[model samples]
Target: ELEHFEMHAEEPSYWPIIAYPKAWSPSAKGTGEVIYLQIYGEEDLEQYKGKLKGKFVLIDTIRNVSPPFEAKASRHDVESLFEMATAGQPTPRPRRRNRAGGFNLNKAIWTMLEEEKPIAVLDRSYKGDLGTVFVSGARTAEGRARDSAKVVIPQATLSVEHFNRIHRMTLKGETVKLSMDLKSSYTNEDGMEHNIIAEIPGTDLKDEVVMFGAHIDSWHTGTGATDNGAGSSVMMEVARILLKTIEETGIQPRRTLRLALWTGEEQGLYGSRNYVGDFFADFGDSGYTPQEMKPENENVSAYYNLDNGTGKIRGVYLQGNDAVRPIFREWLDPFEDMGAQTLTLRNTGGTDHLPFDGVGIPGFQFIQDPMAYFSRTHHSNMDNWDHLSGEDLSQAATIIASFVWNTSQRDEKLPRKKSQEEELEEKREAKKASKAFKAVDPAGSWSYEVEIPGMQVTGDMVIAKNGDKFDLTLTSDYAPDEKEVIEGVQIVDNAMKFDYQSEAQGMLIDIKMNLDFSEKSIEGMMTAGTFGSFPVKGKRNSM
Candidate 1:
C-alpha cells in the first residue's frame, strides 16, 4: 500500500520526495542525463544555466563517512538524572553573527535550478550511514514549498552511498542517465485539516478537563513509528486500560478525560496551536500572542504528552513549574518499580505541549530512555515498526494511565505559572517601590588568577572609564604581548559579567566570567562551554 510512488530511477533506484501532502511538488516523468555543475567563475554559472534544462542535477558534494564507535542506545544514569534535577539557570551564549560576505554560491545554484527547471534536484542525506536516509519537506527558490504561489522544483534526498556513487561516476567523465517518475498528488485542496479529540465525561466536575495527547503526523521517510507512532500507541493503550478499569471498578473520574491526536504538529504545531487559540486564548494579528483570555481557558487542568520514541518513562520534566514538584512526587511514587522516579525543572521543546504551556496551562512531557532514537530513527528511513520496543511502550502506557487518573481525581487543578499580566504588574510595583543605586567604581588594574583544569593562569585586567561607558583590557601571562580589548562590559550592583573570545594555540576559546566585586578583591567563576566552569580570584593592584 504505497501512498504515492515517489521515484523509479536506474541502479541507485528509489529516493523519497521531500514534500508534505499539502506542499507543492510536480508529478514528473522524465529521462535525462545527470550533470554535476562546476561553476568556478561568473560566466560558468551562465554556461551551466543553459545546459541544466531537462536533466537530473547533482546538487550536492560527496559526503565523508565515519564509523560508528559509540553505543547508539542509552538510559538515564543516576548522576545524569541528578544533574538534570538540580540544574540552575542556563548562561546565555553570544548570538552567532553570519560573517560570510561576497557572492552566495548556494543561492546562485538554487536560482539556476528555478530558472532552468531541471527534471529533479538530488542531494545526499546530512546524516546516517548504511543506506539509512533522512528526509523532510521541500524548499522553493523564494518562499516556502507549502506556499501555494511558490514554484517548487522536484527534489529528493538519496542515501549517501548512492549519491556518492553517482557523483564519483560523473567526476570520472562517465555519463549517467536516469529515468524517474514521481507520482504525487495533493489532497485537502482547501487547505483544511483536523485533530481527533475524544473525551470521557466526568461524574461530578464534568466541565473540568484533564488532557493527554501525542502528535500523529510524522516525516514520510519511514512509518514514523518511533518518532511519534510509539507515543500514539501508548496513549491509545492508556485509554483502553482506563476504560477497562472504570468498567470493572465502577468508578467515574471527577474531571473529564480528553485525548487528542493532533495533526499538522510536525509543521509548526498548527493543529494544537489553532485548537488552543480557538477555545482558550484570543490570539490577535500575530496568531500566537494571546490578547484576551476566554472563559473556557480556566477549565483545562493540564496536558500530558509523550513523543520521544519507544522508551519507558523514567520520570518527568516539570517544565519549570516548581509548584507541582511535590504533587508529581506523590504521583510518581507508585511507579518507582517501573523506573519512573526522577523529576526535573528542565523544559523540553518541539512538541504539542508547547501550545498548552504557552497559554499558562500546565503541560508536561515524560523523560524516556534514548534507545537509538537520535542515532538511527527520528525522521529517518529506519523509523519503522521494527525499531519499536513493546516492553518500553507497555511501561509508558501504565505510568501515563495512572498519571491521568490521579489528575482527573485531584481536588483542584494543577497550579499554573505567573501569567504575563501578573508578572508585568509585579515589575511595575517593584519599580515604584525601588530607589536608584549606582555600581561601585571598578576603574583600576586588577591581578587576576583563574584555576582551569590543568593549571592556574595569571592575567591583568584594566578597566578604563570613558565618560559613561567602561572598556576592558586583558593581558595574560601566557601571551604577554597580546592584549585583548573587550567592549560592552555590564556592571550591576557588586557583580560584573562578560564574555571574552580569543584564539590560543590554534583553538578558539570563549570564556564567560561572572565576578563578584568587593572593596579589595574579586571572586567569581569562568565558564568555558563544554570545558566546564573554573574558579577565579583577583586582587586589586595598588595604583
Candidate 2:
C-alpha cells in the first residue's frame, strides 16, 4: 500500500520535536499479531497539563549522530545488489535507507488506538552516501497521524557501516545494546513563532485588500537559507520595492496591499489562509458567478509565486486558466527582453497557493527554472546560504515587485468568474440521485439546437462523459450546412467577435465578447481573457 501523507492549513514552525514512524516488527512476545511502531507527542504533556497525558506519553527526541559525515546501507544504490547477483562477487550491498520499509505508520498508530493498545516507538537516524545525517520530522509525523501513542521519538545517528553492523548482527541472532536519553519541557512559549507582515495602504480604497507572501521558516539543520529564507527575503524585497515605487511615484493604489512572511509554511499554508479568512464572518460565501467559470474568466487580478529556489523565474504558470494568459504575457513582455518573459499555460498547485485555491479564490503559482532544486537543496541538509545565486534572486524580486505594482494599480477589483449555476445544480442533482432523493435532470441530458445564418448553435450544452468534445457547427444559411472547424473569432464586427466555442460534440460554451482594448493599440493588446460584454472602438469599427 502506498503511504499517505496528510497536510493541514495551520502547522507550527520550530517544533523542535518530530514523531516519525520507524518500523514494524514481530508483535511483542512474538504473538505474531502484526505490530506497528512510531514516536508521538510532547516530551512531557503530563508535566504541563497535569493529566494522565490522555492515554498517551512520549520520551526522547531526535538524537543526532556526528554531523552525517558517513553512514550504512542505502536502498537506492540497487546497482550494487545487481552487480553482486550478476558478477558473483562477495560485495558490500548498500543499506536500505528507509523508515522501517514502506509501512503506513500513521494508519498503524490509528489502528492500535482503536484496539486500545499502548505502544512505544523508536525513530532511528540513517547514514548514507550523501555524507550528511539529518533528524527526521517525527513529531510532525505524529501530529499528522491524528492518533495517540506512547511515541518515543528519539534517534541515534550511525555510520552506514555501524547501522549495517546492527542489522547484520540481528540477522545472526545477536543482540545490540542501544541506550538513549531524550528530554524536554513544555510551556506556552513552546509553540510561539513569528510572521513577518508588511503593508502599503491604499489611498482611495484602503478598506479593500490585496496581498502576497511566502513562508519564513525552514529546517534548522541548515541555515534554512534556501528552503524558505530565500523566499522570505525575496518577498521582503518585494515589499521594499513596492514601498519605493509608492514613495517615488506617489501613485497611491486604490486598494490595500500587504506582504506576509509566513511561518510554518514549510508545514502548511498557515499564515496566508488565516489573513484572507480572518474577516470571514464579515462576509458571506463570495462565490464565483457563472461568468467566472467560463473558459476565459478565471479571476485573479494578480498573484505572484516563486518557490523553485532563487532561480530566475523563466515564466509564469497559467494554472490551467488561460483567461489570464495574455495579461501575464503583457506583464512579462518588458522582462522577456531580459530572458524572463515566458508564460506557460500549465497548472501548478502544490505549495501555499493550495489553501487559497481550495476556497475558490483565483490563486497563481510561478514556474521557475529547475536549478538544483532536487540535485541539491530542497528539504535536504545542503539547503543553505552558499547554494544561492544573487542574479537569480534579484531577477525574481524584480518581477514579483512589478507584478504587485501593476495589480495594486489596476482600475477595478480584479476580474473574477462565477462558477456555473448549471454545473452546481447538476452536482446537487447527482448527489440527490445517489441518495435516492428523487432528484433528476428534467432537461433529459442533451443539447437543444438552433440554426443561425452562418452557424448551428448546439442545444443547451451537455457535458461529455469522457471530457473531450467541443466543436461549432456551420449552417447552410451562410455556408454549406456542414460543421466548420471553429476557427477562432471568424466574424469580427465593431472590434468584437462572437463564436460558439464547441468544446465538445453537442456542447458549446458561448463567447460574448468584451476585451480590454489597451488605449493606444489594436488586436494584440486585446485582453480576451478578461470577459465582459462591453464594446471598444477600433480601426475596423466600434462594437
Candidate 3:
C-alpha cells in the first residue's frame, strides 16, 4: 500500500520553478501566458489556434543544459581495464536515430495540445542543469493507459535554468505568468506486477536452479539510482550475503539460489521477458526468437546479471559463450583483488540477461566499472542516492556472491552453447546467401547490370502492389535525375529490406537495399550512404 502523488505549483516571485506533474496529469488549475509552441505545422496550428486556449504551453526547444565539467564519477582505470580486456568484436552500436519520425511528430503535437485547450504543458529538461527537474511521462496522444488516458494535457518538466527563463521571457516581449496545480493518479491494482522472489533451498539440487537478477524498474527521473537503484542494490546485497553464508557455514545451496527482483525492466525486457516466457523458454512473440522449450528449460543452472551502474565488478560478458572462457576464468580467480579480472568474448546487449540469453540459458552479464554509467547516471535526473558506490556496491556483492556460489555448487549444468535449434540453424546458413532477393512479383519488371570502376551500371525495378503496400521503382543510369521510390517493402526470411534517397553532386545519397528472392534471380547488398557496399544482381522480366 504505497502509492501517492502531489504537486502544487504557484510560486511567482519572478523565477525559481521546477514542475513535473504529468503522470496522467489532469487536476489542472490554471494561469496563462507561458505559451511557446514555436512552430508546429498546419500554418503553426492555425496561427496558434486562437492563441492556445489559455496557454502555458512551451512544448520544446530550449535545451541548453550543461555543467558537468567532467568526472561525474569514475573507476575502471588500469587503462580502462586494459581496453575492456583487449577489445575487438564489439561493433554494432550505431542505430539509435530512428525516432519514429520524431515519435510520430510528438504524437501529432500531443494531439494538437488537447485540441488547443492548453493551460499546462511545459517541457525542457532533457537532462538537468541549474534547477534539476528531469521528470518523465505525460503527453498521451494515443499512447494512453495511465489508467487509460482519455485526453490528458497537463504536462511539465522545467529546469534547464527554469526552461531558459521561461524561454527568454517569451522572446522578449515578456509575459510569463504560469500557475499550475497538476495532480496525478492511477493504481487500481490487480495490474499484477511482481518479481521479487527469493530462495536458497538446495541440498542435493532442490529442483536445480541458480538465477540472480536486477532491474527493479526505475526512471521517474532521479532515485532510480544509477538507472537501476544500482542493480537493485547489488542484487539485494547478494541476497544478504547468501543468507549470512548459509547461516555461518551450515552449508546448503547445491542448486537453488534464485533471487529475481525485476519488474518491467524499463519497459523492454518486460519483467525478464515475462519470466522467460513464463518459466524458461518460449519466445512465442518472436522476442529473443527461441520458439519453445520449457520444463523449466532443463532446470536452469546459470543466470547471473547485474546491470551496469555503480561500477565495480569488471569482467564477464561472455555472451558469445566460447565455452564460458574456462568457466569464467575460474570465477575470476577469486576476484583478482576485487577488480574482478576481465573476460569478454563479446555480446553484451541491454539487460535482464536477454531473456536468459534468449533461451539457450547459461546467461550472464557482469563486467561493470564504467562508472558514471554512460556519464552521470543513466536516464539522468542524476539518478540519485547520491550516485551510489559504497565501494562500488561492496565490490558488486562480493563478486556476485562468488558467482552465485559457483553456479550453485556445480556438478554440471552451466556450459550450454548452441541449441535453440542449433542457433536458429546457424542463423539460417548465415542468411542463406541473402535469400536471392525475396519478393518482387507484383506483376514483374526487374533487370540489372553492374561494373562500377567508372560506371557501366544499369538498372530497372518496378514491383508494385497497393492494397497491402509494397512499391518500388528504381530506374538508374546511376542517378539519372534521381526518381527513387522505395516505400515500405518487406519480406523477412526470404529477405528484402528497403530505404532510399538520392541526389549526388549536391549530396544526399543514403541508400540501403538487401534483396534476395530467387526463381529467375535477384541478389543483394547495397548500403551506399558513406559510399561503400555494392554487389547487386538481378534478372526476371518476362511477364
CA deviation > 4 Å runs, candidate 2: 1-129, 132-136, 139-152, 155-166, 172-175, 178-194, 280-301, 417-543
**Candidates 1 and 3, the one with greater TM-score:** 1
In TM-score terms, which candidate is top? 1
The per-prediction tally of clashing pairs is 0, 28, 8
How well is each residue in 103-184 modelled by candidate 1, as lDDT tens digits?
Answer: 2444466677899998888777666777777776665544456665567788777778777878898999877777666767
Ranking by lDDT: 1, 3, 2
Candidate 2 structure quality by residue, lDDT tens digits, 5-73: 111111111112222222111122101111112234323222323221122222223333445343321
> Model 2: number of clashes?
28
- Model 1 RMSD to the real structure? 10.0
Off by over 4 Å in 1: 1-24, 38-44, 89-108, 419-543
**Prediction 2 TM-score vs. true:** 0.51
> Could you tell me the lDDT of residue 502 within candidate 1?
46
For model 2, the local distance difference test gives 0.42
Candidates 1 and 2 compared: the better one by lDDT is 1
lDDT of 3: 0.68
lDDT, candidate 3, 1-543, per-residue tens? 113333333333444466555444666776766777776444556667767877788867777655677765576678866765675432111111222223345556667778887777777655556555556556566644254436777676766777787788778876668666555555644566787888878888779898898888887656788778788888888989988998999888888888998886764566887888888777665454557788988899889888777878888877656787888798889778877888865556557886787677888888787766665567656778887879988888888888898888879878887633354345445766564424445436888764332134677887776545566677777644334666556554555667655543222345666666566776655544422334467888854
Q: When superposed on Cα atoms, how far off is each prediction in RMSD?
A: 10.0, 20.7, 20.3
Q: Which candidate is the best by lDDT?
A: 1
